[model samples]
Structures are given as structure tokens and as C-alpha cells.
Target: MRLSDVWPVRGVELRHGVLELRPMTEPDLPTILDRLPDDLEMDPTLPRYAALDPGVGRAVALVQGYWRAMGGWSPQDWALPFVVRLAGEVVGAQVLEGPHDYGAERVVDSSSWLVQQRRGQGLGTLMRAAVLELAFGHLGAVAAISSAYLENAASLGVSRRLGYADTHTSVLEHNGRQLQHLRLERDAWHGSGRGRAVTVRGVGPALPWFGLDGERA
Candidate 1:
């Protein structure tokens, strides 16, 4: 059987204007690893633990983890990982992860990153909106949550633009230093006007993977 028939979420795709979000496939990994800049710097506002190092080895390891996660996914505990492409070129990634009872809990956590050159052009907002669309619109998520270090203004801005509100704050020790974490949440997302332009494809086959097929009826 085809992979999509076995794990239908693999077939899903989300798109808005020039930006596209789709499950990361093995074929897409090498291009992402090669095109990601060697000098790429992590956002200073993020905790050190959340940062991406600038090195070929680090990138390779990252992709290896991604592959492992995809291979091991189950309906009970899965990560809906997508590669963000702009006009057909790989530029970044967005991931929505959930626990063993995701379908019933209806909450998902998200993380994302874009290449430095693509940071300030509203692409981040668009990319995030697309995923939020998938989370709430397709997967029946009641709330989406994310975290950023207090110093990460860009990430905070995108959350705000997309209707996420500050939920709480905490501190964590990372790299021998304490970093502030700002939790954000959107509990009432209904694919609001923010991502109205975003369109999801391949969802029909994927709904069963997320246990949302009955709801779709």
C-alpha cells in the first residue's frame, strides 16, 4: 500500500498565496539541509535550548531526528511536521505536536523557524497562520500553544498578529543561565480571517489519521 493510504496525514498540504506547507518527506531533506545557510543564527530572544546552531553537522542531526520522528509516528502521539516553501523553494519548517490523547485533549503545541533572510517580510505570520488553520480547522484542535523566550520579539509579534494571547511565564535554566519563557495560547481559533486565504489539500484522506473523519461528516 502507498504511504498515504497507511498514514494519510502524509498526503496533506496547506497553502496561502505563494507560501506552501506540507509534510516533510525524505526527498525534501537534502535540499533543506544544503540550502539552509551555514551562518544561520538563532533568534537572540529564544532560549539557548531552542536555538539552531550554524553548522553542517547540526543540520544533519536535526534532519535525522525529523526522519526518526516521522517513521515512528502513531495516531496517539504524533508530530505534524511541515516544510515551509516559498514559491516552490524550501525555506523553513513548522511543526505541531500532540500527546497520546490529542484527539480528545484537543490541544497542540507548535514550533517553527525560518531562514534569517526571510525573517521580516510577513512570511512568518503567513506560515504560522497556515498551520493554525490546519490545527483548528482540520484537526479539531480547541487550542494551540507555543512558547518563546522573553527576548524573542519577532516570534511574539507573529503570535500576537495571529490572535494568540499571553498565557503565562516561567523560567528555565539553559546553558548555565536562566531564560524567561512566555507561554501563548489561542483557544478559540476558527480559522479566522487571518488565514482565510489559506487552503488545505489532501485533508479528506488525512482526517482519519487525526481521528476527525466522523466530525467531518
Candidate 2:
């Protein structure tokens, strides 16, 4: 049987034109490791996958982390580490995570990366939009949150383009770097018309895993 038959999360897929976002399968791991963006000196405060040093160690940690997420999945806390593909070629990764008490809070957070050569093509924005669609349009999220180092213009740009407003700014004590936080409410998401054309498949069976009773949009 296909893994998706037992693990519904593996069946989830988000598509917007040439870009697609889906759970990273075991077979995709090696290719993703090879295509990870060259060191951009990611912020130490970012998610472990994004902050790790590139090479064998980071690759191994990522593989283990992927398994841990799957094994630890629950309604209260879960993460979808999505492998991003642009025109059928691996580009990077995007993750959507729900915190403890997620059912009560109805909020979700997202993080992502794109290889150096893909930076200027706007794929980052498109991929992010696709995930937000899953969060707000399907998963019943009341708000979607994102953060980026103050110096990372590309990420902040993607956030703004998707109607996320500046929520706060804080310093990461670990690195003393300023971090910009942004949020997009469901109404604002629908109003922005971003990801309007994005289509989702295989999410129906995954709703319960996301702690939702049924699809919202």
C-alpha cells in the first residue's frame, strides 16, 4: 500500500500553476538535501532545519526531524514540512506548524527557504501563498503568522504581498538580531485574493489530523 493510504498527511498536496507543495517523502530527502540553499547564514533563532550548518550533519538531522514530526503528530501540535517544487524541480522547503492548544487558538505559523539561484523569481511568494491557502482556506485557521530577520527583505516582501501586516518586532537574545513578525487574519486572506487560483487535493482525509471537523473553504 502507498504510504499515503495509512498516513493521510502524506497525501496532502497544494498546487498553484507550476509550483507545488507537499509532504516530503523518503525518496525526496536526498534530492532535497542536495538542493538546499547554500549557506545564507540563517538566523540562529530560526527553526532547526533552517538554521543548521549545511553538509552531512544538517542533512542527517533533517532526516531524523522529518521522522520525528511524523511520529509525534497530534491534534494539539503538528507540523507539515513541505518540499517545494517549481515546474517539477525541487527548489526548497516550506513548513506550516500548529502549536499546542491549536484547536483553541486557531493560529498557524509558517517558515520557508529557497535556494540562492531561485531567489528573485517570486517562487517564494507563490509557494508561501499556496500554504496559506491550505491554512486559511481549508484548515480553519483564524490567523496565519510568520517571522523573518529584519534584514531578510525577500521574506518580508512575500508576507506583505500576501496581506500580512506588521504585528511586532523583537530581538533574538541568542544573536541580538531584530526579528519582524507578521500576521494575516482569515478575512484579510480572503480579501487579498492571493492564492485564488491555487488548488488543493487529498486534504479531505487529512482534516482530522489538522484538528478540524471539516474543510472550511
Per-candidate TM vs. native? 0.83, 0.89
Taking all chains together, the TM-score of candidate 2 against the true structure is: 0.89
Name the best candidate (by lDDT): 2
Give the residue spans of candidate 2 off by over 4 A: 40-54, 215-217
All models, RMSD in angstroms:
4.3, 3.0
Kindly list the per-residue Cα lDDT of model 1 for residues 103-144, writing each as its tens digit: 677777777878878879998888888888777777777777
Q: Which candidate is the best by TM-score?
A: 2
Model 2 lDDT per residue over 103-217, tens place: 8898999878888888898898888889888888888889999998898898999999889999999998887989999999999889878868899888998888887866565
